[model samples]
Target chain A: MSQKQIAGVTIDVNDEGYMTNHAQWNRDVAAALAKEEGIDLTEGHWKVLDFIDKDFKEKSAVPGMRRMNKVGGIETKELYSLFPNGPIKKATKIAGYPKPVSCV
Target chain B: MPDDDEIKKVSIIVSRGSLEGVYPGLIMANGARMKGIDANLFFTFFGLHAIVKKKMNNIKIGTVGNPALCVPTPMGVGMPTWLGAIPGMSWIATAMMKKEMEKIDIPPVGEFVEMIHDAGGKIYACKATVDMFKLAPQDFCPQVDKVLTVGEFYEMSAGAQIIFT
Candidate 1:
């Protein structure tokens, strides 16, 4: 199929082996995280999201907890409260930060 | 705006010297790790005390010259930093800071350092500051990754964001 449509999002796969639709996946993941974390989509939440987005834009790697705290000004206790799965891994996943090689 | 492919790296440097200063570095470094970015913290000067085992757990707030002191907040006004050096003043400031830390849930510096390491952030000691202050590895927490020169830190910090908390 030229395009696979899911939940009104389009997924394009090219013959060159590039797979699209990751953005859609990111959005879906982010939304799920918002709900799970009880995030109200306020400026504070956006601050964290924007930070993660910027980091992704720069490093091509998901930010770890240390970098997130440094850039986002979020506390470790707060992060732990927000993400029970451990802030280092869960927050990045929710923020749509690309998976780090060490994570798996 | 450049596409994702054009992105390079994100790095942060934290150097600060108050009870509050240590928090920012620790918090930031942990946050960076959460985002999957390479994070390094260079603890130098008074900031170095936060990593030292004996001093880390018992840091005294500098009430003298502390901007927070003058703030009309619930925490009460503090003395000046210069005054903090007074023989008895350091003890009072230390006591006050210890009390405040207790009131909050903030753990001791040693514990905080462990948390940073557990979360995968890199910690380095400043060699020059160590020599200047007559500190050795034994003087610091065991979690320290290395004692490095400022030049070494800069070499590692290249192309990464360097922040002074």
Candidate 2:
């Protein structure tokens, strides 16, 4: 773990730039991190990030693509369009969750 | 300079009919998309079963001539080849394998292919195989994008890594 300043606050982050402490994550930090990914948090983007955050807090695990489609009410293609490239990994990072574990 | 050696795309070929044989290609294709890489899955020979609307989900595990087939016990002894040849042995093995895959959240073959497609991965059927099997377009799963000859596949997969599973 390493300390990095995000959104004007010192925070602990992993080597991959994911926030290590969930408590330190906020909308500003998420937006700042998303900027590094070349993403401007739009309404669609926020919907996914918020769903991931809620899912992590309630289920205590990162939601995979299927759960994001079936339970989280986001279409697979829409998720891809929202995050582009690596949706699950990118979304999880912005949502303050660890890398996703499930493949499907 | 950007890393020229980085893998920007992958084309995986699935040529086997067994359940285990089909999944590696699917997983790889999906995983490529997950990495923001372009990916394609080409189904040929026996692998066509994986795209056949009727047979995709009913695929069975390879039981015969496979040294890897084993019984779940303390000893972990491998199943004898002769025993593997027995009828219903493959069914039993397939059932157990599907159970384990489910425990880990691996979706069924049909659903898996759809997931890969939904992620923008292309799925193709080999022209030669389709001709040999006398398969019509309607015989394939809905997610299959096209039927292409080897030359056509190579044309599209240019500058991409090709993996035969």
Candidate 3:
């Protein structure tokens, strides 16, 4: 774990720059992280991030493509469009969650 | 594509039909796509069963001669080779494997194909195998993008790492 200053706040992050402590996550932090990934958070993007954050609290784990597609009402292709590369990795990082395991 | 140190593409040849044989290639191709790498799954021979419309959902484990069926037993002992020949062993083994995979959120073969395709990975069927088996285009699952000849397969694999599984 390491510390990083994002949006003028010291936040704990992992080697991959994923926020380790979810408590430090806020809109400012999320926007800062998204900016670093060259993403501008839109309403669609927040829908995914909110679903992930809420689902993480409920399941205590990161959600994968299947869950997002089936339950989160997000299509797989839409996820790719939103996050570009690997949606799970980028979404988890911006949402203050851990890297998702390749579950599905 | 950006000129970088990262591997940009991979062409995975899945040549076996057995559950164990097929998952490695599927997982690897999926992993590659998760890394933003271009991945292509070329199914040849019995591996075509993974892309066959009917057979894809019913992939079986070979219980009779599989020496490495190391799945858990009810008694926590290794599977005996002789026990594999028993009637219904393959079915039992398939059920156990499916249960275990489901527990970890791993999808069945058909859904796995859809997932990879949805994530922008390509799926292909070998033309020689399809012709040898007298299969047609409609026999393959919908996610398969093409049935490619050897020349076409080679052409598609250019500049991509070829891994035969």
Candidate 4:
């Protein structure tokens, strides 16, 4: 594990830059992370991040992409349109969860 | 070919009918979509069974010539391929694989296709194969976006990584 500062807040992250401690996550940190990823957070982006955060809290894992589209009402195209790089892995990381176990 | 970093899409050609043959393509396509890479699954030849409405659910693991099936032991013994050729053995292997997949929460073939479709992966069947089998467009699962010729597949696959499974 290594430590880095985002938005002037220091937190532990793995070699791949995924946050190691979910507790260090906050809305501000997420915004900073999104900015670093070249994403401008919008209401739709927040909808996905919020859904992922809530679902991860309850299920202890980020829901699969299919479940995200079906239940979150975010279709696959829309998801890609929002994330535009790595939707599941990137979104879950920004949402302050570990990398999804099933995402390739 | 586009440089590795320039790959914006992935076109997976599924050319086999067996569950073992098709699952890798499905998994890869789904993974690509999850990663926000455009994904297209092109089913050709017997791979059409993967998207055919009545046959997708019935994909069997190819037991004959399969060298991977083995009885677990300290010595790592494998079942002989001849035994695999025995009638009904494929079903057993399919059942075992299905059970293992269920334990890991992997969806079945049909449900997996549906999931991929919902995730915005494009599914295509080869037009020549479809015409050869006399399969109408409606004969395929609703997820299939089109029946395309090889040239069209190549056109759609431009600037994409084309993987064969």
User: Best by TM-score, which number?
Assistant: 2
By lDDT, the best candidate is: 2
Regions more than 4 Å wrong, model 1? A1-104, B1-16, B70-105
RMSD of each: 11.7, 1.9, 2.2, 3.5
Q: Write the per-residue lDDT of candidate 4 for residues B51-143, one digit (tens) a residue.
A: 998999999988899787775431368888799899998898788778877655567888889878867789999999999999987789999
Tens-place lDDT digits, model 1, residues B11-92: 3444556676677677666556555456788888888888888888766655666555532332767545565456766466
**Model 2 lDDT per residue over B1-165, tens place:** 376978999999999999989999998998899889999899999999999999999999888898877788414798777898898988998888889887666788999899999999999999999999999999999999999999999999998999999
What's the TM-score of every candidate structure? 0.54, 0.93, 0.93, 0.83
Residue pairs with clashing backbones, model 4: none
The alpha-carbon lDDT assigned to residue A48 of candidate 1 equals 64
lDDT of 3 by residue, B1-165 (tens): 367767989999999998888998998888787778899999999999999998998888889876776647644566778899999988889999889887776789998888899889999999999989999888888899999998999999999999999
Model 1 chain A: weakest 10-residue lDDT segment is: A13-22
Report how far residue A100 has shifted in candidate 2, in Å.
2.4
Ranking by DockQ: 2, 3, 4, 1
Question: DockQ scores for all the models shown?
Answer: 0.09, 0.71, 0.62, 0.48
Ranking by lDDT: 2, 3, 4, 1
lDDT of candidate 2 over A1-104, digit per residue (tens): 89998799888988888888999988999999899999999999999998998889898999888788878999889999989999999999988889887766
Model 4 ranges with Cα > 4 A deviation: A1-4, A38-63, A66-82, A101-104, B1-6, B72-76
TM value for model 2: 0.93
lDDT of each: 0.63, 0.90, 0.89, 0.86
